[model samples]
Every structure is written in structure tokens, then in C-alpha cells.
Target: MEYVFTLKYQLADEDRDHEQIVERLFEAGCDDATVGMGQPGRIALAFTRDAADAWSAIHSALQDARKAMPSARLVEAGPDFVGLTDVADLAGVTRQNMRKLMLAHASRFPLPVHEGSSSVWHLSDVLIWLSGRGSYPISAGLVDIAKATKQVNLAKEARQIEPRFNRQLVPLLA
Candidate 1:
């Protein structure tokens, strides 16, 4: 099984070389990792690993990153959830097509774990649904990466939203 996590780090300098830092993290065994600029002076790292060793993998990667950039401070880290975009990518369909399929086959679709502007499902649930459809050539590894990417984007968006507005939003799925 694969598990995904997103890590945000604060950079001491806003102008720090992000690509170089990400490359170093990659070299440290974060094979499925991607980095992006977060709020000013911050960087976001999203990665996936086997469920059996996710904690070890994340710990080692973060340690390596901290060693490489002494000023990098971990801000937040958590499990990455899958959204419609991830399912669309895994199924080789457009987001519109994915949404349409979900709506048309609502009873057959897995209930999302979270629902807001974009509903989010567990990666395993999406994969099982895709397998049942039997129309898409889906790979678990690819889906894991896509899920992590989607989660990272969601986290960024959440950070950008007003706290009051966000507080009023309730997830459809517990």
C-alpha cells in the first residue's frame, strides 16, 4: 500500500534556491517527491511511500532536507488526500469527464472523504472504482503521485483562504 504526505517548510530567506533544495531532497531518497513555493518564504514538499515504512521515509527525508538547508523549518505535515483531478489523471480522462462520470454513476461511486469546492476521495477508493470500470489503464504508482500532487494543491489553497470562510465549510464526508 502507498501512503502520501505533504510537508511545508519555512525558508530563512525568501530568495532561497528552491529547485536546488528540492534536488537535494530527491537525492535523499524522496523518489516520489515534488516541491513548490508556498506562502512567502516557505516551500511545500509532497511525497509518497510504502505504507509499511512511511514514517521512516518521511523522517529521513526531512532530516536530510534540514541538514542540506539549516534554516529550513518544518511548518506542517499530514496525510495527502485524493481529489477529482487525481482520479481524472489516473483514469486518463479530463476533470470534466471524471465529474460527469461520478454524477452519472453516483450510486456506484465511492463517497468522498472530504467535500468542498472539490470533493476528495481516498486513493484506494478511486483505484478500486477505476478497476471496476475497466476502461482506463491505471497504475497504482502513478495514482499515488497524482493524489499527492492534488493534496499539495489543496493545502496551498486552504492556506490562501480566509480563516472565517474556511471554518464555515463542512466536509460532506467524515
Candidate 2:
């Protein structure tokens, strides 16, 4: 049986660079995927089961792509996190800028549940959030083979994106 891995993505105002977005998706193993129609910031990538499986092989591609850039953290789309980092790995930012953007974003994260005495985000929440772009500002990195089994609340959040369940991978956006 062939599985269609439909990758649906939304762009924030800051992510206006189409080249960058394409590069990121390509590195994420969406190369050769046919683009389905959507709003300007949103796109649907249709991939064959074989290509989707390559996700695991190219897991580290995102981090590798971001190696030269500072403040760039990986976002994931799967059952391994809530929202990941609050900070963007960009240059020429000041202390005040960091505090301003990051501070509010932390609280914006979905309520993390308690595992024992510690509060940790669940991979399940991350997956659900990815399924529904009801939660924005979520991100992930390319998959890492060595650490494929390991689930880091933030790291895995970047490497893999949770996909839509419906036949058409479009966000309800309500």
C-alpha cells in the first residue's frame, strides 16, 4: 500500500522568503513533492510513501542547514514535544529584543503537563498541534538517525512535523 505523506506548512510574517522555505522543506526531505494549492503563506506538499520514509534518513539536514546561522532553532512536527524554543537564532539582536520576543512566547506555549514533580511538554501534544495548525509558531528540524528513538521535547519538535489527518492537508484555520 502506498501512503501519501502530505506536509502542510504555514508561514509567519517573518518567514516570507520563499527560497528559504523551499530550502528548508527540501532539507526536510520534501524535495520532488508536488505543491498543492493553498493561501499565500500556507502550502501542501504531496509525497510518496518512499519519499516520506526518507524523512528518517535526512533527519539532521535541518540543523546542518542552520549551522552557520545563529539563534536558529529546529522546529518539529510530531509526537515528541509541545512548542520548542522561544528564541530565534538570528544575528544583530539585542538583549532587550530577545527578552521582548521570547518572554511572551514562552507563556504562549501549550500547557505542559507534570511528569512527577517536573513540568515537561509531551510529544503527543506536539503531534496534535501539528495536525491542527490551530497552534501557530510551532517548528521542527530534520530527522536524526542516531537519535531517532530518542525524544527531546524541543529537538524532536523541530526534526519531524506532525501531518494532517484529513485527505486534504489544509489547516482549518478557525
Candidate 3:
């Protein structure tokens, strides 16, 4: 099983190079970490780890990142989930084909955690099913990395949409 955490931080100043900070974080043992520039003076970091050791992995990564770069200040961090598009991409199939397979073999395929316009599932469940399918030319390591990347991207999209809608004013919003 794999777990993903998306973290946001504020850069100390313009002189603080974002790429350099990312490099340092990676060197500090964040092997599955990806970093991107967010708003001005802010950056986002995504980290992935096996579920069995996620708590320790994240704690260690945070400690190492802080030690390596004192100027970086953590803002928020949380887990992220993946959806059908992510599964299709990871399995090297079109979304339509993936959905077809799922529908045809509903007994074998795991049900999604959230079933709406875009169904969501835990990365581990998707990877486990994909690993058993001979059509997918993917390894365990690749699945872990891909799952992390997908979760991070999904979380970013959700964050981008949240600000545009007001929960009180839009009661029927999906």
C-alpha cells in the first residue's frame, strides 16, 4: 500500500531558490518527493511512502527538510486520493477502456470509495488490481511512484476549485 502527502510551505525570500530547496529535500531522503512553485514566496511539496511506514516516513522527511533548509516554513499537509483517470494513465489504457473493463468485471474490480461523475479510489487498491492484470506492463515500484504523482495532482485540482465556490451560497454544488 502507498500513501501520499501534499505539503505547502512559504519561502523565506526571493533569494531562496525553490529548485535548490527541492534538491536539498530530495537529498535529505525524500526519494518520492516532487516540488512546485505555488503563489509568490510559496512552494508545494508532495511526498509518497508505503502505508506501513507513512507516519515515520513523513515525520523523518519533515525533519530532514527543516534541517536542510531552515528558511522553509511548512504551511499545511494532508493525504490525497486518486481517480479513474489516474488509474488509466498508470495502466497505459484510455479512460473509456478502463471503465469498460471495470464494468465487465465488476466482481473482480474493487468498488470506488467515492462514486460520482469522477469516481475516486485509494491508490493501493488500484495498483493491486493492475498488478494482477497481464495487460498492464507495470512494476510495483512504478505503481507506487505513479500513485503518489496522481494523488498530488488530484489534490492540487481540488484546491484550485474550492476557492471559486461558496458552500453557503451553492448548496447543490457537486
Candidate 4:
């Protein structure tokens, strides 16, 4: 299977040289990705990799990226965070219809990860919610990728939380 994803990293100051970064990435089995160096001190790799599963593709990409820049920190792995329009488009429904579904099933709809002017959600959460409702045209591969991305992003975020705080907070959240 070919999985498409983006991995963004915050480069260490010493590793910000574009030419060396690009060559290192390519040599580290990242020839499958197109490296983007837009924001200063940041790099984004948009990859279309062939692997047995989305997880494998993403995992290997992360390893390759790490190999290229050992000091780089992961910023995000995406197609995980999105809004109603994104979910609607993937599910083959209009945004209005998606809004209607959310409004109609306020009690059951997946909660947005962010709630404000424009909400955001973990793509897998919304997809799973729709899948439970009925037959939807959402692709299994997309859902798989969404799930993998969500996990990657969440794990990245988790590493930042202080262990003592996480230990205390875990039981409370549960």
C-alpha cells in the first residue's frame, strides 16, 4: 500500500543548513519524500511511501528523518487534525450536511479537539463516528492513515508532559 503523509520537524539550529539537510535526508532512505524548507528552523516532508501499512510507512519515514537529523524534534504528523469541511469532503458529504449531522446528533457526535470560531478534530474520531452511523464512502486507507497520524501526533505531545503530572493526571482523566 502507498500511504501519503507529512512529517514536520523543528530543526536544531546547527542543522538548519538546507543543502546538507536535503542530501542527508535523501541518503537516509527519504528519497520518497519531497522536503520543504519554508519556515526558518523547520522542515516538512511530504511523503508518498509504499509499505505494508500506513503505520509502517509513517514509522519508517520517522526513523529515516531522525537518522538524517538526530537533533531535530518532531512538530507534527498530519492529516490528523482537521475541521468539518475536511471530514465532509473525505466522507463524500457536503459541509452543510456534516454540520447538520453534528447539530442533529449533538449528544453523539465526536467532540472537536478544539472548539471556537473554527473547530478541529482528530480525523479518525470523526470517521469512526460516521462509520458507526451507517454506510459512508470514507476510504479504509484514509481512516487507517488518520488513526496512525493521530497516534503519532498524540505520542509526540505526550512526551512533552512532565511524568509526575501525567501520572497524577492519568487517573483523574480516566
**Highest TM-score model number:** 4
Off by over 4 Å in 4: none
What tens-digit string does per-residue lDDT give for candidate 2 at 32-147? 45654356766555544332333443343333324322233333332233223322222134536534643465665445645334344554443333335343343332222112
Clashing pairs in 1: none
User: Each candidate's lDDT (Cα)?
Assistant: 0.69, 0.41, 0.68, 0.93
Give the per-residue lDDT of model 3 (tens digit) for 1-174.
Answer: 565666677778753776677787778776677777868888777766655545555566667667666777666554335687877887789989988988888998977769898887776577778788777866665555445444544554566565547465457754
How many Å off is the CA of 8 in candidate 3?
Answer: 4.8
Tens digit of lDDT per residue, candidate 4, span 76-154?
A: 8988999999989988999999999999999989888899989999999999999888878877888898999999999
lDDT of 1 by residue, 49-108 (tens): 665444455556667667666777666564445688877886789999999999999999
- Of the two candidates 1 and 2, the one with more favorable TM-score, higher being better, is 1
Model 4 lDDT, residue 156, Cα: 85
Q: On a 0 to 100 scale, what is the lDDT of residue 86 in model 2?
A: 20
Name the regions of candidate 3 deviating beyond 4 angstroms. 1-34, 39-42, 46-59, 66-80, 144-174
The estimated TM-scores of all candidates read 0.49, 0.28, 0.51, 0.94
- Cα deviation at 100, candidate 4, in Å, is 0.8
lDDT of 2 at 124: 42
